[model samples]
Target: RTVTSKMDLLAFHTNTPNESLISSENGVDLSLGSQPLENTKVHFEEKQFVCSECGKGFTHKSALLTHKRIHTGEKPFACADCGKCFTQKSKASVLKHERIHTGEKPFVCLECGKRFTQKSSLHKHERVHTGEKPFACSDCGKCFTKKAYLVVHERIHRGEKPFECFECGKYFTTKSYLLTHERIHRGERPFTCSECGRCFTEKSSLLTHEHCGSAIGCRSCTTGILTLLESCAKDMRPIGFSLSHITYCC
Candidate 1:
């Protein structure tokens, strides 16, 4: 159940003809005989089609053309349902993305009965019940249930902040953090409270405001600590506690 590395994937393919390669069905290898040669010169010389932007060699010109879209930021495959575009023109990706709009769960787990839009997600979720952490950090012995989680954790040891804030000089280990930081620079508050016409940088802030503002009817107290104090004031007022005394304690 271990995740495949880039080298493992590359090694699976050989330039030599009929090398007796291992085959897999549902991630289970049928045969494990005859180990493939590693770090062979044929791998570099044999790949005819090469990418201009990244210099990644591809076996076919069509693969290289499909890969060029990664550098160009092109997503030609547009979903008719939601207008979302995808770089990979695969039917699986189109089907998976459409599930977001359709609220469909095609892949289901037999263990917990939890459903997922994609097969990969269901595969990852099955690891939770099995307690199988296939991805492990090389620097530290910390393991992750998902390969992406392990990759993100390795950045901490490598001191690699791949995501950079273009607005400011700040850098982040993850893209989501960089995106959240960019909102601050752009003064973009996407999360809004429908009850009150107030906006927040994060959705959790809006939820907290809504919880407290509903009881106190004070949407002006946007701060979480202030909302917490107001919530406590409402509860304590019933037990013979003065607002002045509560304010002094705060």
Candidate 2:
């Protein structure tokens, strides 16, 4: 039964059971009919509700209303812990951001007992033990456990260094390396040796110093040992300096 006219719509609605006409706040009586009302003349065009800013349209008025918030820069969702505002009104996003302040990691790996705030993060961490590299590079046959790592690795093949140092105009593959390089320009040695109180620009340098300090007894002895080893292994010489080297030197 196709409703071709307003009379057919009214006849169809009147025959329906437990249906009633509803009124809008503007006092427009919107009837349960297929055609447009005589008084209200409300018609739903295809993609009728359009945004004023970006000209994006939605079929539903409610969807258009929600889409308008993007142009308005409206973020109704706020974190109770840190008062941080997020554009999304979802409770899941709020809970995930709240985990930073709460330090609550509910998702745990059974293999290593390593916990993560999100289940996806725990799944990625589990791949380390499983040796599962799901994300593969198209340029090369190298694979990574996470998609983000694969994206970063692909930049190497493309020779794309998006992160650049402002002072030296030098580029780096990762943002963290760029930040670490910037610390050098600022003379910031963040990593400090607990044994000798000597600061280094990178953590790996501090770690190597700690290992040398542990093997040689003191800071002065460690420096001497490093110098002697470098002198012996100079000009790219292959020297098997292991724990036995420390024993022999001591």
Best by lDDT: 2
C-alpha positional error of residue 232 in candidate 1 after TM-score superposition, expressed in Å = 14
Q: Which stretches of candidate 1 lie over 4 Å from their true place?
A: 1-76, 83-90, 111-113, 187-200, 203-250
Per-model TM-score versus the true fold: 0.51, 0.63
Per-residue lDDT value at 28 in model 1:
33
- How do the residues 1-250 of candidate 1 rate in per-residue lDDT, one tens digit apiece? 2223435545554443334433232343322333334433223335779898989988888889889998999999888877888887898788788889999998999998999998889999999999999898888899989999998999999999999888788999999989888999899999987875778888877776665443342334444455334554354333233332233122
What TM-score would candidate 1 get against the native?
0.51
In the predicted model 2, the residue pairs found to clash are none
Model 2 lowest lDDT segment of ten? 241-250
